[model samples]
Target: MSAWLFDLGNTRLKCAPLREDGAPGEAVALPHRREDAAAALAQVLPARFEVAYLASVADPALRLAVLEALGARCRRIAIARTQARFGALRVAYAQPRRLGVDRFLALLAAHARGGAALVCGVGTALTVDLLDGDGLHRGGRIAPSPATMREALHARAPQLPDTGGAYREFAADTDDALASGCEGAALALIERSRAAATELLGRAPPLLLHGGGAAALAAHLPDAIEIPGLVLDGLARWAAVERAAGG
Candidate 1:
């Protein structure tokens, strides 16, 4: 039976085929605008699948629209949720549901990599998670991403350009200063998290970067490993475990 994985976030929806090797195939991203989600999926998705596994962190109405579209093409749909434990990984959240499934899935993917990691997801929001080699989720932080920060500032100030400009240590212009400040803030947080993780774990964890905004920051962090398919990869793992248990 053929299956697919869907990751619906605040800004976009990414779908990919679940391969026989238990991995997610190349992902196709679609804008998750409220009115266009169904139309967008209809244009790109095939007519049928035996199962559709979804991990969503979007508005209810938007999720319903996508679910309606998937229902027409898929025989079964499985929605992923945050869990206190998944295999060896133990979530640090006292209330698992409070933790976004996207972050949980990213932690799952990072733990599968078999080492300590500082996982950063840079999208509508910036998220940083620490996972020990033993599959313990040490918690994380969330804040506005650089783009979101710029957009928020523009929304309030009106005169500040929402986009453009380059990052420099000492920017002389307003545009450059905005870019540097926002991007630097996010970068600084990631570095701080990494440093703290090192102190706690007695070793510096490898930084794993993911999400739409990751590439922009990747250029600045030479040691960071960018895995664009991380969440989908974790979904694949989740599917595998579910299947193994005959779910």
Candidate 2:
């Protein structure tokens, strides 16, 4: 039976299926709007799937809408949670119930890879959650993403032009200046959290980078291991757990 996983994030809804070998199948991204989600689901889900899992950070109303669209197409529909152990890692949230499903899933994936890790999700926002060598979550940080920084600058100072690109080591002009400013800020936030994680874990952990802006930031992160589908891998892992649990 095929497993379907949905990550309902703040900006977009990412959907993917787990192949028989438990790897992520092709992923589809759609706007967070209900209509868009319905349309995307209609196009992606095949007739043979037997199970569905949803990881949503959005409101319950929106989640219900997506479920409504799915409409008994699968035998089971499990909502992703911030619980369950995948190898060494345990979802370590002061309130695990309040933890974002995506963060929880990512930690599971990192633990499955086996080792200390700093899982960074860079999208509309930048979130870094850490898992120790023993797979114990040690908490993390959240900060403005590059686009959020740029948008804030533009919103506050109307004269700045909309811009984005790689930051030069030494910015020479206005464009580079803006890029460097935002890039430096983001890097500082990321590095500081990474440093703290290393100190806590007693060694520099491997950084697993994911999310929409990961590729853009990967070039600048010499300390991180860029993984394009880290979250999807986590989703697939969660699917496996749910199936085993008889859900």
Candidate 3:
């Protein structure tokens, strides 16, 4: 019986099978543009899976498309959702559904590692969530990601091309300036959040980074742990709980 997990983000789709050890196998990522993401999914997925689990943070259209595709190819499919509490992680949101499942899942995965953690996700939006050692979510913030910042700049100014940019400390050119400005903004936000989290928690939490743009920010975040497929890892944890509860 084959089980598969899909993590559909705003710009990319990631999928992999659950290994016997309950870990996701070598995952494959597909960009939403410059490629037919659905076709890639079809090509990569097995002919039929016994069960399929999905976590989506994209638009309704993207979610619908993925559901339609997976419905036909799997014996059963379950979509992960934002919850008030799961495992050791508890949502800070009074209205739990208002929180993004991706964020919740990231928090779950971070807490499972056994300590307070500051989880940062750099995807369509730069999201940071702080989870204490007791699994209490300390809320989080969301801001436009570097790519979004570039796109927004181009959309507003047009003269400043959004593409082709390099990050530099003191940028000498427009490209470098754009690159550095956006990335520096994100780095600054994370650093500030880490400091504030330390004060609130009475101890500094380990910074955990994930998502597509994580690598770009990793160098600047000296001690941040790069956890691959965090959302998927979280999904695996959720699935186990579901299976145990007789879902």
Backbone atom clashes (below 3 Å) for every candidate: 0, 1, 0
Q: What is the Cα-based TM-score of model 1?
A: 0.98
lDDT of 3 by residue, 1-247 (tens): 6899899999899998999888899898887632355576787897777999889888887778787778878988888999998866799999999999999888888888999999999998999999999999989999998889999999999999887778899999999999999999999999999999999999999999999989999978789999869999999988888777877
Q: What is the C-alpha lDDT profile of model 2 across 1-247, one tens digit per residue?
A: 7677788877777888778788888888777676566676777778657777788788787888888776657777788777645556776666688778788888888888987888999877888998888878888888888877888888999777557545887888777888888878878888898888777878889889988778778888876788766777888887877778877
**True lDDT of residue 154, candidate 3:** 97
Q: Candidate 1: minimum summed lDDT over ten consecutive residues — where?
A: 30-39
Determine the C-alpha RMSD for candidate 1 after optimal superposition of all C-alphas: 0.9
Off by over 4 Å in 3: 33-37
Cα deviation of 210 in candidate 2 (Å)?
A: 0.5
Better of 2 and 3 by lDDT: 3
lDDT of 1 by residue, 1-247 (tens): 7999999999989999999998998899998777877789987788887999999999899999999999999999999999999999999999999999999999999999998999999989999999999999999999999999999999999999999999999999999999999999999999999999999999999999999999989989999999998999899999898878776
Ranking by TM-score: 1, 3, 2
- The per-model lDDT (C-alpha) reads 0.94, 0.80, 0.89
* TM-score, predicted candidate 3 vs. hidden true structure: 0.96
Per-residue lDDT value at 39 in model 3: 75
TM-score of each: 0.98, 0.89, 0.96
Candidate 2 off by > 4 Å: 84-87, 170-173
How far residue 228's Cα lies from its native spot in candidate 2, in Å, is: 2.3
